[model samples]
Target: AQSVSQHNHHVILSEAASLELGCNYSYGGTVNLFWYVQYPGQHLQLLLKYFSGDPLVKGIKGFEAEFIKSKFSFNLRKPSVQWSDTAEYFCAARSTGFQKLVFGTGTRLLVSP
Candidate 1:
């Protein structure tokens, strides 16, 4: 069975602070990685993804992540975050050509101005 686990359930941050959230999965085989963000009152949108190739990938809103195959981790990082970045972040993964996705419970990021 495959599953995702987020280290934090909620986080509070001040504007312009750096942010990093942990994500790990329990899968031994190949898989596609993704980070989806849902802004306040908005639908989920793709922040970034890792299908094949490089381990490091960048996404919209100055976000990036590195996929560590050995650790079974894909952690999200932002050098500096703004209040607008406040939202719920979900780490998801699925096997190649798999239709369904397994998502983490989610980490709520609250950035204060």
Candidate 2:
């Protein structure tokens, strides 16, 4: 079984501020990691993912994450955030050959303009 942990429960920033949220997963074997964002009144959307190949994964809305296998971390980052980027971000992990996804508690981001 795989589990995820998000250290940042909440974050506040002004527009154009750089953002970084910590995410760690527990799983020794091959696993897939993902970052999902849920905006106000919107469903969860995929922000980025790291399955294989390069560890740095680029995603929509100027988001990116790097998978560090040794540290079991997949932290998300953005060069500059916008007010529209405010959302609840979740980190998830799924071991290979598994059918279920383990998710973190989620981090709430509030960007002020």
Candidate 3:
């Protein structure tokens, strides 16, 4: 069975620093990718997604991700980050023709003002 992997367990950055998180998956077929953020006590917020069309997906809050089919990776990146962007980011993958969502280990981002 294919699975998701997030090598970075935790990340720290300044309020105006850039943020880049790694997200990779192991699947042989076409797949849908997603990036979700969970604030301190809020529900899951979808940051961005890639279903088709352009390989690069622009998500909410100035975030974007690139889907590399050959690498099976959908890395999330933000040109600049703020204190409010501090949250737990999750990378998820769902193969085509399936309704299952496989999530990565999760990456915790900390931003200092």
Top model number, lDDT: 1
Q: Could you give me the TM-score of model 1 versus the true structure?
A: 0.97
Candidate 2's C-alpha runs over 4 A off are: none
* Clash pairs (backbone) in predicted model 1: none
The window of 10 residues in a row where model 3 has the poorest summed lDDT is 26-35
Across residues 1-113, which tens digit of lDDT does each residue of candidate 1 receive? 89999999999999999999999998767899999999999999999999999999999989999999989999999999999999999999998788779999999999999
lDDT of 2 by residue, 1-113 (tens): 56799999999999999999999999979999999999999999999988899999999999999999999999999999999999999999999778799999999999999
**Clash pairs detected, candidate 2:** none
User: How high is the CA lDDT of each candidate model?
Assistant: 0.96, 0.95, 0.93
CA RMSD per model (angstroms): 0.7, 0.8, 0.7
Task: Give me the displacement of residue 84 in model 2, in angstroms.
Answer: 0.3
What residue pairs clash in candidate 3, if any at all?
none
Estimated TM-score for each candidate: 0.97, 0.97, 0.97
Lowest summed lDDT window (length 10), candidate 1: 93-102
> Worst 10-residue stretch by lDDT in candidate 2?
94-103
Please give the lDDT score at residue 86 for candidate 2: 93
